[model samples]
Target: MVEFTDIGDVPSAEVDRMRAVYQPLADSVRELVDATIRTEMDADTVAAVRAEIDAATARLRSRQIDGAFGVRYTTGGDSLAWGNPVIGVRNPIAPPLTIERDLEDARGRVFTDFHLGAAYEGPPGHVHGGVAALILDHVLGEVAAHADTPRFTGTITLRYLRTTRLGRLHAEAAITRTDGIKAYAVGHLADEDGVTVEAEGVFIQPRWARG
Candidate 1:
């Protein structure tokens, strides 16, 4: 699905306003998801809350865009992909990673510091391997993509060293090299203790961009 709408060159102030409006909503929804899992409320109360939630969902659906909110960029180069699954400000499913670029490095290095709570668990008390892949894939892809040669993942390989605890974690990636239309990158996901998952991937720029 895709969001087919034009959000013209919105100014930075307007972008901040948009974030103010939607990020909070996503925060509340994210909290609700967490609460829904841990809540020990009475059955009656749970049913009542479910009813209210249903009503709220209906109200929101009453007036909405047609498809997924796709990435939009400003003339200044700022981007808003608020519905993205990993970092979308408007998506509760996201850990909502906060990625930072290392300007001093020449590899287009990027890192994210994020936390995963009860909602992202796979094993008894650990985060899912797939979740780690999802984060690393996006991070690696970000580094592999160049301004002149936007790319897509061609292959990704991951190594699970140990179980990732569901808590604060750090991850980063940097492009190692590029060959014509392809870029290669490496990254890892880690907890306070040490690295838990490492990844390497190749991202290829589409042929259309070669011209």
Candidate 2:
């Protein structure tokens, strides 16, 4: 297994340099996803492109270490979760979330900025409802996990107030209340105009976690 370390222990300078190098690669992958979804190539050309992509994927895969990229920290105290589904550096499926967290407040607040592409479409030019729910679940879970109180989702409820447009979008989440082992959180997804979806969730610290 590949041993993991948190980025927290890494030198700030090294972390900055690594981010500068890897971020552009991540952005390029993101653009590739967009291009793949929007391309209008003919069948034979598409097949050729797919074969080339497969070759590239195979090459990268061969160079990668085995297993998932678990969270890791360097000896210098910098932590990195480079494979995180929402903001992973190497995960091509993620929407490249730039999540911001407010750590000072008792009820933690989390926000993310991202753009949805054709792969996320539902009704015509709008984003899929399930995709919105997935984003809310992640943000709400983060609110529950903020400040080291990591909790697992016990229940979630989502209300689709409107069709979310497939473009730049904002999401926000905050812990609403907590009672004993359970934490309640509220979250929303919005476009430039206003809120499109709202969510409420309950999270529980597993029994082993309390010990």
Candidate 3:
């Protein structure tokens, strides 16, 4: 598993409490996004629903943060990347990928499984190529973070082997090698049938982010 020694100073109990309070709201928002994309309601009904949504938005806007919710952590060494665009718990536009990492090993391997709905449609019934890249990019980054070595993507190249359908998908990434400050990693995305995308990336430990 990756380490967050330099991040997430909050308490684990507090983090869990916050998630318990907010995850349901986030889930509802995700559902709203899916419904909005697939709704077959009439124009008038849509307008009315839009009005209600606006009202709710206004209510939430009454109290707001001034900036993005960056990565946060707990005293117990847990970090929550909740505002992440691809996996954030508080983000509705995310595929909301749930990642699992190998804590007992240092290979920097990570895996995730998620379902893409109508909100992620492209190429008719298929997922957008860019979306696949997004998922792989994030996973590859994590794969490079194995053994708590924090890094950022320097470059990533992806090849689409086949069209990914709009349903259950799986992805995995692992570090292939490392050279000084550079970590090379490879990953792939697959559906039930087989591989759909392959990616390799060079992750760099930025000077500024290093202790």
Candidate 4:
């Protein structure tokens, strides 16, 4: 479902300032995730690092929200989806796809080029099938939302052709057809070899929009 909170009172300047301050921390946390997976330090060093991590975690928890981060909008009509798992700039777990709106022959297309590092591996050197599904769902949802009225994912099907390797990858989704309040779209995940997974999804207008 689409959610955008109004931060009309908070100066846009402060919003940008907070984002600039925290985004790099998220980037470092992502690097920390990769390092945690590959580190080969001595037991003492690991313990020392863990202590520092614990202290940092405690400090961060001292002033934190009790719920998931919600989408916020700026006065200039910009949305900040900073907590979204697929593309949240503030989320350390995101492959962080920056989907773009491109039209081919006058059809709306949403595409993103991203990378999956060590933290996302499920099968040795390949990306997890579930992760691929997650990417497609979000990508397809973007396409579904770009039409006259926004939509939410109703159902999605994915077909795995070959293993998706962990490296630079591409994904795109485009609406093929629509019926009433429904939209159908197709997309895929690809490596240099070609499409590794194919996806199609059914999206429907929210109940509020349906009426």
lDDT (Cα atoms) of all candidates against the true structure: 0.90, 0.83, 0.86, 0.89
Model 4, position 69: C-alpha lDDT score:
84
What C-alpha lDDT does candidate 3 achieve relative to the native structure?
A: 0.86
Question: How well is each residue in 99-123 modelled by candidate 1, as lDDT tens digits?
Answer: 8999999988999999999999999
lDDT of 4: 0.89
- Tell me the tens digit of each residue's lDDT in model 4 across 77-179: 6678899999999999997889888855455888999999999998999999999999999999998885347788899999999999999999999989999
Pick the TM-score winner.
1
Per-model TM-score, in order, reads: 0.94, 0.86, 0.91, 0.93
> What TM-score does structure 4 among the candidates reach?
0.93
- Candidates arranged by lDDT, highest first: 1, 4, 3, 2
Q: Name every residue pair that clashes in candidate 3.
A: 1-103, 8-73, 10-74, 10-75
Rank the models by TM-score, top first.
1, 4, 3, 2
- Candidate 1 accuracy as lDDT: 0.90
- lDDT by residue for model 2 (92-177), tens: 66786778987787678989989888878999999989889888998999888743455888999999999999999999999998
Q: In order, what is each prediction's RMSD in angstroms?
A: 1.8, 2.9, 3.2, 1.9
lDDT of 1 at 25: 94
lDDT of 2 at 52: 92
